[model samples]
Target: MLIDEAYKSRILRGEKTTTIRFGEYEAKPGSEVYLVITPSDTAVAKVRITNVERKKVKELTNQDAKKDGFKDVKELVKALNKIYGELHGEDEVTVIEFEVVEKFESGIPLKWLKGLNYRNPEEIAKLYIENNLKDSPDVDLIIRKVYSEGLKEAVRRYGPKRVRDALLKAYHKLYADGKI
Candidate 1:
């Protein structure tokens, strides 16, 4: 049969392959996901944007894009802003909202000085009950590391009281009796 011959030929030609679109990613309330792909390939990657209501941040990888883990806002902001600077002149980016859409209750602590629009308590509580996050230990570890490093600058900016209150507010909003 022609179909059998075609299948045999495909097998013999090493054409067996698996499709791998990026899997579903869960971004915690006090977190976000940045798609870092080749600048040349960003438009293609952007097409795969499935969640329109959920804000997505675009972080163009460096010309020499490596798989290094970003540590904190200080480091990520410094590096990512540099990427923005480089692309500002070279590429014509049409849209960039640069918004904080969500923040987890038990996420990286910050004063939220600028008070960018963020996902509120109810949405986050829903996400928590649903257990949408991957439930990976690395997620908490990364959040803690990023929070400690980022909160230092925020405290210096907004003072310790505001930072403490903001963190306490988040806690109280989630757990009224401080039983976390």
Candidate 2:
């Protein structure tokens, strides 16, 4: 779901649970969806759709507007007009209600991690090794240890704080980039 950046704070704060769209959007109840902010296309949070309703513009009430984080029906109508042009009372619209499932501390563009092999501590260690430590003499041995023993075991065996710090940094980078 692509939401306007202006409503990011509201969504994060749990104040905006409903969104009114200009058409009959194909969203199913109980489906989980990522809420990506527009322009930047950053995935900020995950949400579960609770309901989907179709109604005419005239049917929108103050309660609906409130759920959408609007002051009143009039305010919602004006905003809708700005987004969808001149809408008549009988025009149809889709109302989507969702609940926040998880919020990302730092948002990441979804595209960056699409090609990643895995999302875990091991993957972070691998990325750190391959990208930053590839030229070191012990690189081959470290790679072998990482694959054979896994991240936790390798960290315990080596006790390399640099490697640990790198792994932590890589994990946060991937997480912020929406990989993990």
Candidate 3:
């Protein structure tokens, strides 16, 4: 879920407990959410949904408005109208009430990744193959892990195609070098 910087800070400070969005929310109650701060694109906290309510805009009460960081129903409606543009009081909105479960550092810290010991995809593939050679060898799992986790930052920096190509090249190189 995304929020502006001001609201993100409030959520982190345990001031905001509810978020109102202009549509039906897909997340079920009890599901965890990573609140991404917009403009910065940094995930700062994790929250668990305690309740989710779908109701018309006009149905919001003062309590609901307070949970959403508004002083009262009028202010909440005004803010909603400004963001949504001409909201008919009848427009549906999803009120997601959550509790912050944990706070996270700004971004993926390079320091922690460095501790993993593998610098690139080739090293990752090499380690995976070596570790699983005596057991069940699942190259697909290594590929998936690399694509999803190891190369996440790279994918964000250089784009998916480039990162994928590089990973494939490294995997093939293992066979070429007769290391697997």
Cα TM-score per model: 0.18, 0.66, 0.60
Which segments of candidate 3 are over 4 A away from where they belong? 107-180
Candidates, ranked, lDDT: 2, 3, 1
Q: How close to the true structure is residue 62 of candidate 1, measured as C-alpha lDDT?
A: 28
Model 1: per-residue lDDT, tens digit, 1-180?
001122222222324111111122232332333222232211101112222222112333321122112333344335435544432223322221122223222332212321312333233334333442322353333323334545445456666565544544443444543333
lDDT of each: 0.30, 0.74, 0.67
**Model 3 scores what on Cα lDDT?**
0.67
Error of 1 at 51 (Å): 49
The candidate with the higher TM-score, 1 or 3, is 3
Which candidate achieves the best TM-score against the true structure?
2
Q: Is candidate 1 or candidate 3 better by lDDT?
A: 3
Instruction: Give the alpha carbon lDDT tens digit for every residue of 93-154 in model 3.
Output: 99999999877643422232233322345355555455443222333544555545555555
Worst lDDT 10-window in candidate 2:
112-121
